[model samples]
Target chain A: MELEALSVGQYSFIQNAYSFGFAVMAAATLFFWLMKSEIAPAYRLAITITGLVTAVAAYHYLQIMLSWGAAVDVTSGEVISTGKPFNQAYRYVDWLLTVPLLLIELILVMRLSRQETIKRTTVLGGAAALMIVLGYPGEVSSAGGLRFVFWVLSMIPFVYIVYQLVVGLKESISQQPESVKNLINISVYLVIGSWLFYPIVYLFPLVGLEGGAAITAVEVGYTVADIVAKAVFGVFIFMIAMRKSQEIEGTASTVSKPAAAAENETSKPS
Target chain B: MELEALSVGQYSFIQNAYSFGFAVMAAATLFFWLMKSEIAPAYRLAITITGLVTAVAAYHYLQIMLSWGAAVDVTSGEVISTGKPFNQAYRYVDWLLTVPLLLIELILVMRLSRQETIKRTTVLGGAAALMIVLGYPGEVSSAGGLRFVFWVLSMIPFVYIVYQLVVGLKESISQQPESVKNLINISVYLVIGSWLFYPIVYLFPLVGLEGGAAITAVEVGYTVADIVAKAVFGVFIFMIAMRKSQEIEGTASTVSKPAAAAENETSKPS
Candidate 1:
């Protein structure tokens, strides 16, 4: 991708966003890891995957910050190109690894049947990967038409994942304990809504925003979406897990030890 | 770590070992990956772990080669430093990841019971990690006595692993099918023997050898031990897995798949 020059204000905004994104992701990772033992064994892997997602995002955000520093020149009192490329691919790479993982953590938190879990994750996770792969060509393309082509192509899988989350997982979500059902439902919608934010940002240049404005909007937009999708969603996962564990514990206490394992269907998600 | 300067001949020798080590490890990684499905599902995890060990080794060897290139100045003809430190920690880092994996792969090939598998892997893999970690401080220490102290500390774990492989696994080895019993036993010995070679190499500087010869001996020694320990042992693991699969197939045909799972056990190693 061609590099973009920015005004000092635009440059400062992106730099701050990158720094804040890293801090949020890093914080989420630490939060998940530290809170892991509070959840039931069955839900811990969901938290672990959540941790992994945030950790991967934190690493990429750090990389993006470093790349931005190397590729931008501010010593002249204005933002100028440093003749080195800012690796926009870092965001795509982060999304590629974490998006599928995002779907997986949600699937895990639902405690679906083994075959159902495998089937949904295989289809949905594979779709998430395909969506990202299809989107990348357009992401790096200079031509607006080519970018739009990939946008449409990627949307096929994007829509599939959204549908799978909203409709296909309805049964599983309903079966979750009363305390966590709404939590999961809200988290699912949060994923779909945050993900929708991604493509709109992808269209910044195509929407006639140019140069610094377009780049700034895209960078800041993606940063905001990432925090909402990963960190905020992670907090929701933590909440759902806490609620589910309490459900399991409450049932265990009322019905005695025999019912302890009735709710924790799966030991670990794939 | 203090950097070591080398003679031209020593530099060339160490360089060749680094290059050849990379090729060996990469080739083993490819071989194990390609042959994964050929093994019984029960033993394929062993193959996968083997692949991981070699893959990690390949990556570190590549890093070592790059570090070597950047640290050495060949323009002087006689060996000279570029003032950039050659990172010797790559070897320890590689061991930290792959050594535990090496132990786990062997346990998987044996197909021990779930409890047995978990217990052995926890104890042995943990010991392997401790061995590597303890050795690192000594490897980097300038004082021979301090190095020797760490060596002794690391040996505590090393001997435990060797004993676990030989004496502790005696019953597991005996229960193996006719075809793979000796194969497992031989691989066990191979591990114990190859591991011994590492400490010998670690002691090179403490011995009479000094300067270029000591660095060359240690480098070449560690590289050879790595190939034998990882690549060669991986091949042994592959052979054992192949034999176990064949045993499963042979019994599967006669007993009509009521025994398809007879020899194979534990779907995946941790």
Candidate 2:
């Protein structure tokens, strides 16, 4: 009971660690909202991802309350069984918060890049689906098996995404502004960084590891990293979302200039 | 024993119902693989969504296996608690199948319409997030409460999407092909139809629903609707994705025409 009680001590660290992600998400949402009137086409995907991720982060913050406060009944096993509102609440929040963000990120990349290939999008979508399945409730039951399945499943999307990032970076350099490129690269790297914890989480549980401290450390560390990647860095992605309108306006105006000039020539007193 | 046998029979029906979803999902994946090399950019989002929704339908099928399969042995009063593996597996598959599709649909709309409004995209993404959350395992645990929540959550995204469709139709009347518009309208209607089932599912249990007949009807009906919406209708949406490359190519070729014409005029026997 004492050890279980001590688990509550981690909340402050979590709150502090997660704050950065929250701030980023909130800032990004606001950024998009404020600039709603001026945003352009190319930037639309990025901004949408930013806003959705932020909302997810916000909901995730609430998930901690459900897990620790609501779901944790001392009478039950220290290990929570996802039976009722509490477990469902926790997993539901987790799914809702993260899935769309992943989807948004992939879509943003595909839409922004010059390669708008259907095959590429299909492959990416399939990979992402594998990752999602690996994370679902049924997978959570068989920790070892689920971990193995998901580790393999998640790889399909994760590797494909990295490939996309590289290709997208190359395509973006020619078309997008420097700011957009930098933000996108950082965001992709951050997302990849967050995923690194999956293998650690998967493997640590499998080794019959019972060091309470070590498990806590890994769990907390992963949570913090995810918060930063998806939320804090997510804000920077949002900032780019905010800047989308300017980028589109700039491109459209550039494209429209020739048409405008042609009109001028036709109207001239020749 | 008779009552127990009856319950067992009920559970079996539930399990098989979800199989339909999975079968369609596999079909969807195969469909995309077959068409991977041929589709155009305009149809990318639509095709990806169609493929993913089919996958989601398949995932639901798998989930029925997990949920109903486990229901057989648990004592009547006890909560049918399958371990974490079961829960996570089903939810993960659901997320993998649905989120990217929703995200891609929004991106497709943004690019296809050329409207480029940040507000619209963010709104769409937010709606997608809400739908994803509602579709999560925990969200549907209490068939009664969950069904209501699901209906509301699903509606938000659908309504916002319809708005996007209206705006897109008006904005791109000149540039977009009539075939693309027809596909878009049909896809929207189909998805909306699937969403309508949430209320029916919710209402059935409230109206004292029981037995293989009622449950089978609801489960199978929902599954069929989703297949048509996400897979069959979705295939038509893929056709829409095929139209985009030509438009972009047209822009590239025509935009340079005046420049080429001017250069020819200037070099003419001067």
Candidate 3:
């Protein structure tokens, strides 16, 4: 599909998605920084990484938004050659930095042993980064065959990342306190589920979607996925951190003074 | 200022703002409904009402977004008549339903007596609805004089609402637990601060900003304010509700068994 012009609706959808992404990412960064919690050092590292992922994505999204805004020919509803070309590449740039961090953050919060954490982070993070880098070629390709090839190649790493999350992380997740175990599983599922949309968006043109409608769908779909994967996922991370912190504290108190801890537990409203 | 053509950028900005608003509001509605907390019945009512406000706003925003999307002449970057006229009135409709509910929700969360809740809800809600209704004519008017007239008329109720929030609610807010009293005060301040942006957006043309830039400014500004006023404000409300719930539960347990409660309190990590 040769790229030509976008409808006003298509342009707007794309622009708005970037703007929304920028705002939410920035807000989440600040929130993770400022939120008061007594989580363990490992969990705190996870929070920090989460903030970093958003902060990095936010900066790139701002660039994408401005580029899109500048490219639009207001009088023609056409995307023209702005002096600074519309940088769709920014999305890939963002994913390159943030995707790895996202995986690392999840691993950190699980409080796995140093060796296990290092191994999982390296493998999963590498797979995530490779998936994004591979997808970029498809995202930019005009030929359907070329796009499909790159997309399929990207899915190889995507499948690996999912396997790591669902199968490899199972034992570690099971070790978590009962209160947060389900939440961890849900977070993993959310990442996998929302991510499935990206590939569909990539192949929309191949599937007979073209022009303004296709562009609009792709932009809107990506925006929804980004929000779920980043902001909503961040919220789950924060909750898990808090829950883990409480559990650790509870255990420490019980160990230190059994009688006092029992009385304390009894008094808490069920 | 006669309403004329909108630039591609302007259309996109407006559409994107509405889309962003719709997503956030819908997400917030679900969050308030689904979040597990041990808050009081009164606080739960506040949560439900909070969800209601956002749900209503989200529906209206979708209408506004689609209307804008449909209005655009994709090739010309002009907003043409699409048998379905662009319904700018949807905003007023939203505010009419939500503004009053916003006030009522805040008051409800305070856990005031039934008599006080009804009194405040009626007065504040009425004033809020009137304020939004009065502002509609100004929003639609092309004439500066007519716009200013309705704007000033609307301020009458706006000022009254502000006075009620700050003065009438002062004593009640003060009665909250120490941890949440400041949060309540800050939330009120946040509401006032974010709301001030709306009138500024409404009067941008009066300040000499016109055409696409002005329209973009107004739309973007309004979206930012809405997020802060509704979403961020909702967060503060949640925190306050949780704090109050904790206080009440603590009091009940302490009253039942003083020694155990004290032990529980001391063991809890600050």
Candidate 4:
């Protein structure tokens, strides 16, 4: 919380990162929403959630940029504190709201059985919220010991989510038309890989980075991760929806994946 | 905006209304969500929106109760402000977020033409948000004349919504089975009838009631209306979903409703 004078490079890095993050999220929201009608009716909700996730992220990124502008002052050549704390909680708030939605988007796009869709969404969405809630206290606390404890606690849910994405939804992902099955798999990994950035940035202060360096690393790291996790992953989800819609409409006979397998897979416990 | 001391009766009345409101919204959220799988897949999103509307309402009602608790104290026998402004904005915030969803729920359940669904939801949902936004400035201001100006401004969108709800979807309602046609029709009336409570409450002070009396009237009136508009309307939406699901799954043949007539209804513009 101390007033650390930030070098111009350090200050500009975060500002630009936030600006880019906001732009991508807003763009993605518009893209997913506009394309919703093109998706199959069954999968339209998936696109809607994707739009909502990006829209929520876009709002928070704007808030982050405004908070950064208010917290930093560059009127005297060097960027330094205006004695206001940069509002870091916006990221957590954004995650708390959108993280579950992100998971729901995945489940909805799968077009699983009705009961399975409800079950998966409830469990995965609940776990996402739990993970974010557990991580917040550590995010705000300066004490490394307290932060580490909460980080470990948060990783419990994180691990569960990773397991679900990697193994639990494996069959559901496999049952998709052969064209998109692999893409959905890659999107799942992208979620896991990008989500890991949060905890890594969280540890920068614990691992010898502090002051302006810590702030820049944390902010820029999270922003970059968010762009990939939300924007990039969202594109894949959109593609999956688009391709699946096409496969569903363009005659189910064209898909190399056998129809009987998909029908049988629907009956399996998710 | 000087603090007014409320009698114990007045304080208890608002407190109890909020308690009941929160309970109803929370309960409706659980009911609609848990019963989701029972609804037909096409109608499930409408039920989901119903759950979200109530969940959002539940949260704001909790906030309103906490704000009421903090703003009023009866420790010295008469209730008076603790100097913190009771967050009256929570009401507008709740309405702003949930009102659009309420209209969207109606559209989704109608399962209108895809293009029509998109068009009606975009237009109607956008209008609901505009109505809420226009009403806020008036609610916060003590200038009766200024409030009157906003009241009229807000009425434009409100009238548009009432038109859409009462007459705009008339064909869709008539196209349903005899069992639910009347229920859905009554639900629309319930929506129109309940929504009028807010403006009536908004005009309470302007119409000569003031101070504790006005506060009591507004708080209690909005609470009652919210319970009906959200919780009650939500139940009706759920029933519509349930009946439609039954009609879809039970035997599309058992109904005397002509398939050709209903099929033709889908081509009509919303």
Number of the top-ranking candidate, with TM-score as the measure: 4
Q: Per-residue alpha-carbon lDDT of model 1 for A1-270, expressed as tens digits? A: 333457788889999999999999999989987887778665665787788788778867887898799778787676667654566777776786689878888887876654576578789889998998898878767799999999999999998888888888776676667778788888998999899888887787797776777788888989999999999999998898888777666665554431224443322223
Q: Score the docking of each candidate (DockQ).
A: 0.04, 0.05, 0.07, 0.05
Clashes of each: 0, 44, 1, 0
The stretch of ten residues in a row with the least summed lDDT in candidate 2 chain B is: B261-270
- In order, what lDDT does every prediction score? 0.79, 0.51, 0.73, 0.78
State the displacement of the C-alpha of residue B130, model 1, in Å, after optimal TM-score superposition.
25
Model 1 agreement with the true structure over B1-270: per-residue lDDT tens digits: 223457555665576567657756765675677567557799988999999999999999889978987887554245567788889999899999999999999999888899999999999999999999999999888899998999999999999898888899898888987767877887888888878889887777787566777777778888878888898899889878876775667456643332223223212122
Instruction: Give candidates' CA RMSD values in order.
Output: 14.0, 14.4, 12.8, 12.6
**Tens digits of per-residue lDDT for model 4 on B2-73?**
336456556655665676577568756755775675567999999999999999999998898788767766
Return the clash pairs for model 4, or none: none
Rank list by TM-score: 4, 1, 3, 2
Candidate 2 CAPRI category? incorrect
Per-residue alpha-carbon lDDT of model 4 for A116-235, expressed as tens digits?
Answer: 776898899999999998998787777899999999999999999999989999887776667888888889999999998887877777887778777777778899888888889999
Q: Interface-residue RMSD per candidate?
A: 14.9, 14.4, 12.7, 15.1
lDDT of 2 by residue, B1-270 (tens): 112323333443334335435544554554554354345455555565666666666656666555655544434323343433333235435644464465456356435435553445566666666655655543446566666666677666656665765574456433546535665666656665665665456467556665556756665676666566566665555555644443444355655433323222222222
Candidate 3 local lDDT, A190-239, one digit each (tens): 89999999888878888888776776777768867887888779868987
